[model samples]
Each structure stands twice: as C-alpha cells, then as structure tokens.
Target: MSLKPSSRDWQRAIADARQGLSAWHVWNLLAMTDIRQRYKRSRVGPFWITLSMAAFVGGIGLVYSTLFKQDIRTYLPYLAVNYVVWTLIQGIIMDATGVFSSSGVYLRQEAMPKTLFAMRLIMRNLIMFAHNIIIIPLVFLLFGVWPDWEMLLAIPGMIMLLVAAYPVVMLIGMISTRFRDTPVIIQNVLQIAFFLTPIMWKVDQLGAAAPFVVGLNPFAIFLRIVAEPMNGRAPSLWTWGVAILVIVLLYAITGPLFARLRARIVYWL
Candidate 1:
C-alpha cells in the first residue's frame, strides 16, 4: 500500500534539503553565472573588470598621489585595494537594496527562491571583486612589492569579512524593499562616503583629521576587520573573533525576521 506524506512532513523535507545545500556552493555557482552573464557579448569577458580597475588605479594613482605628494609605489596599491573593497561594499549595499525590485518579475511569477536572488547579488559582486583582484598582484609586481607572512593573514581575515558582510546585506535588502526611495538616497550617501572614507591615503597620514576618520566612521570600523591584514599587517585575533561573533548574531537574529517578512515582500512590490 502506498501512503501519502502529511503537510508537515513535506515542509520538513524541503527545509532539510535547503539547509543541506551550502551557502558557499550556492555562492560559487551563482558568482560564476553572474560573471558569464556580465561578459556575455564582450570579447575580453570578465577581464573587463580587471582592465577597468587597472585604468582607474593607474589614472587615479597618477593624479591623486601627485596631488597628495606621495610616492606612487606606496600610494597606487593602497588606492587600488581600497577602491576595490569600497566598490564591493557599494555593490553589496545597492544590490541588496534593489534585490526585491530587480527580481520583481521572478518573485511574482516564478517558484525560484528569493534568498537565492540576494545570494546571487552577493556572489556576483564577489566574482567581480575577484576579477578586479588581478590588479593587486600586477600592481605589486610593477611596484616590486612582495607579500610577506603578514599578507597571508589576509586570507582568513577576508573570509571573516565576507561572512560578516552577508547577513548585513540580506538585512539591508529586506528593509529597502519596503522603502522605494532608499536606492536614490543610498546613491547620494555612497558618494559622500567615498570621500569620507580613506581610500588613497592612510588615516594616520590624514594628520589631525585621523581621529574623526578612525573613531566615527562606520566604514573604518568595517575595514579594521580586513584591511590591516590585507595591507600586510597581521590582524588581531580579538578583532577577527569579534567580527565572526557579529556575523553569528546577525544571522541568528535576522534569519527568522527575514523569513517572516519574506512572504510579505511580494505584496509590498
């Protein structure tokens, strides 16, 4: 005799299967697809991100370091790394904010996952970010800079940063879906933030303005977790632990909150 499963059993099975599908795996596949789509008609493909980054770094490096009266060797890489990280942050924030709107058709018409859309945005940014990363090594080689053991510390630190960043992205995506004006406001604020945050010059190099830049800046707080290690300084264990802890808290709190609101998102749109 064949038996039919109860409603609860079907729901539980679906949940279990989703839980088993790792976020990392989803991110990797989505990221790859995003890169391919981004370069669909282009000859150079995803290398465009790298090429553009190189031009930006080279162009800005020549102008900014000259204006700042700093050496290009030291300043160029700093500018490149900072700009890459800043771009990724902006992409994540903006992408999350528009996740619902951008995927409105799919959300309304299809059975495809909502969380996957957000994940895809993050993954897409990461893939582009990785492509841009090629500029780092090229710059390093041109400048004759070498990564010491301290630089190796950046791998784990960046991993921590990515983990900490996702839930924040998801939360922003959910909140912005409820507020249509958020995207425009975010664009203006991001422009202001670009100037406010230190990209080309070190905070310490900013002289008296250093304290305000360090203590009050949210981007500074976020960068502290990853930038130091990336720039060849070993990140503190305490800082890494704190960043990871924050990630855990964000997931634990936002997961259920987002889930409850997930179904209502379509109505809002």
Candidate 2:
C-alpha cells in the first residue's frame, strides 16, 4: 500500500512554490549583488562583456556578410540583433541548469522558495542581456536600419520570450538538480542548436526547405518574434501563435512536476 499527499498538502506545496514571485525583491537584489561582485575589482565592470560581444558581432558580421554575398547594410544589423537575442536565450537555458546547485548554500540555510533561485538566475542573465543590447543601436546607426512603429512589437515579443523563459528555467532547473549531468547535456545540445538556428544565416537562403527548417525550429521562431519587429515588421501571426502554443505546452508539462517536486529540491541538493 502507498500513501499520497493529501489535497491540503498539495495545495500548501503549490502555494509555497508560487511564493517565489512575491519574493521578487529578494531575487532581484541577489541578482544585482552577483553582478556587482562579478566585476568588483574590474574598472570597466559588466560593460567588458558588452565590449566583447560587440567585437564578436562586428567580426562575425563582416566575415559572414562577405561570404554570403549579402549587403553589409542589411546583413550586419540582422546578424547583430539575432545574435544578441540568441545569447539571451542560450544564457538563460545554460544558467537555469545550475540554479539549484548554485543556490545550495541558501537552500540549506533557509526555507525559501526554490523558484526564487531560478528567478535570480534569470534576472542575472537579463541584466547581462541588457548590457549586451547596447550594441544593437550602434549597429542600427552604422547600417542605417531605423525602427518604425512595428518596432514597438518587439517589446511584447520580448515580454513573451521572458514569460516563456520562466517555465523553461523551472523545468531545466528541476531536472538538473536531480540528474547532475543534465547541464552538460544541455550545453552540448545548445551547441548543435546554434548552427541549426538561423543566427548567422538567412532563412530564405534555404529556399524551399526554409519552412521545414525555420518553422520547425523553436529558436528560429523565437528569433523571428523579436527580430522581425526590429527589422520594421510585425512577426507573422503564425510566429506569435506558435510561440504561444509552445509556451503553453511547456508550462502544462513543467508546472505539475515543479509543484510535485518543489520540496524534494533540498534533498537533491
């Protein structure tokens, strides 16, 4: 015979799990502290990362634009924006994988919500993304890529992406806590995904196969959602619909698991 958690026990666990949102200030502060400490002695601080990314994007854009025979005016801006967005997505997924183990000290010392740690990780990455994004406007100016009203849509697209990130962080964070090797696996997969995604390449270049390659690729879908707006066009309805559908499915699967295993995280750590 086996015993299951009673309804009240489950309810309490869920409530406790959701409490992380209310503790946003705690996670936000912790994330800021991490940024400060990471660059404590450095003169340039986090902007060093921004400079590095700028150099990378510039170098890659020059080479790829030449190789692909694309106009520098068009290709450089496209590459710059897409690369920044990809970095944000990649960083979130990679960092989320270590959220629990990295916060083990706090988890052991207190009864705080596990999701708080995940939020901190996401917040840290968001801060980094913000810094790295400064180059986009410079690229825009260099390439004469001006934004229009459609650019406003990028705001919602970004919000949707961040909203989608929460469930992904929770799902990966939970699995990583248990498996330990999950982070390594996720990193390897992301490497493969990078090439498959249309970051340095254009979708139309693939011709007839573009639909299957770009449409089926979630990262591509995500890239289009944010990138199209910056390019002065609203993403197709299909893009928004697919993005929302994927997020809904992700939450449906991960939400229950998070609720069920929210307490087991401490032991796993």
Candidate 3:
C-alpha cells in the first residue's frame, strides 16, 4: 500500500513557512526559537558556548603565546578576534551541513519551504556568534590594544561577509541533505581546512606563501577581507573584489537550482 499522501497534507507545511516569511517576523521568530531550543534544559543556557570559547582562547593563547615568545596581552587580542570570527565561519559551515539534515523530520512531518529551515540555521549561528563576540572587547581591555580607525570598517565588512556566506550555506545544505555522507565528508575536510587557514596565526607568517594561499583558498580570502580591516590594516582591494565576485557568482548559480530542486529534497532525505 502507498503511504504518501495525495497532496494537501504535504503542501501545508511548506506554505506555512513561506507565508511566515512574508512579514520577516515569523522567519526571525523561527530562527530565534531554534536558538533557544539549542540551550533549553541547560543550566547555563547559551553561556556554555561563551565560557568554553573563553577557556579555549585563554588556554591556547597563553600556551601558544608563551611558546612563540609573543606577549600574552597582544597575542590574546589577536587570538580572541581570530577565534571569534573563525568560530562564526567554522560554525556556520559545519552546522549548515546539517541544516537540512536536522530539519528532515520537520520537513517530513510539515510542509515548510525548506529554505526557511536553512535560513533558521544561519540565524541560529549568527546569534551565538554575537554572544561569542563578547570575547573581543574583553581581550581589548585586558591588552589595552587600540586599533586604528580601521576598526570601524568591521561594520560594513561583517555585513559583506554575511551576505557572502548565504550561497555557501544554501549550496551545502541542499546537497548534504541529498547525500547522507556529505556532512561527514565536509566535517573532515573543514577540519583540515581550518588548520591550513590562518585562524590561529597571521597569514603573513607564511611569508612568500601568503599570496599563493590567498589566491587558492576562498576561505582564507573571506576571512582576510572580513577580519583584516578590524585589525588595523586594510586588505588589498583586489581581495575584496574577488571575495564579492565569488559571492555573487555562487549565489546566482545556486539560487535557481535550489528552487528547482527544493521539492525533490524531501524525497532524498
């Protein structure tokens, strides 16, 4: 006997999520609700992420700073900012893989636009990321490191980064749902990519290899454009150009394909 419903039941959830997006309020609420659910029943709420992050940077910063013979105060701020941005980058890329995976049951039981779940995944990370950012000002205060006026550049830079991340998030989330093994593969690869990128150190430390690194690694390029300006240095205009170009191209390429395949996504899961 066939188990699939005729039509109406399957369509309702998708319609609800879509209609909910109309006001932007429901979409934001869905995203916020997901964030809250992540901390539910936890004694510390979301502070766990913050506290763990603090310990991570402090412990590692002290060890590495001492080993490298760099002063703890200076190194701490660098590590803090780097870790914070890297946390956002790594978290989004890693969590995005399962945006669809985690939402599979929801999709099967309800008819939400599928994209709403993906957006919610992004939003959830964005919120925790904000919490984690508290690490930065603390580092600045402890270090007395005064950034150049370039620090103001973070406002626009971050806006650009978030806009740029959408394509990566959408493309990965959709594909990972279709291929059950994808999330695992991405996780393994990203772990390697993280070490290779300059999350814990300055890319310039690579010396002659820095240019080649930037040319070949989109993740590094993204991090550089977004983080450099805040560190009191302006990234090369060419790098920003390339980052934005890649973002626009990826979004254009993935946008329609996602819409076309959005329905089939449910079956794949």
Query: How do the residues 1-269 of candidate 2 rate in per-residue lDDT, one tens digit apiece?
Result: 12255566568667765798789899999999999999999999999989999999989988999999999899988888899999999999999898989899999999988778878988999999999999999999987777799989999999999888988999999899999889999999999989988899988899999888888888888888988888777888888999999999988888777767777889999
The candidate, 1 or 2, that scores higher on lDDT is 2
State the lDDT of candidate 1 residue by residue for 68-183, as single tens digits: 99888888977877787777777787777887777787678965556666677777888788878788888888888888777776677677667666676667777788888888
lDDT per residue (tens digit) for residues 85-132 in model 3: 888888888888887777778789987666676567677788898899
Q: Is candidate 1 or candidate 2 better by TM-score?
A: 2
On lDDT, the candidate that comes out on top is 2
Give the poorly placed runs of model 1, Cα more than 4 Å off: 1-30, 110-112, 236-253
TM-score head-to-head 2 vs 3, winner: 2
User: Which stretches in model 2 have alpha-carbon errors above 4 Å?
Assistant: 1-6
**Cα-based lDDT at residue 70, candidate 1:** 89
- Ranking the candidates on TM-score from highest down gives 2, 3, 1
Give the per-residue Cα lDDT of candidate 1 at 194.
79
**Native RMSD of candidate 3 (Å):** 5.1
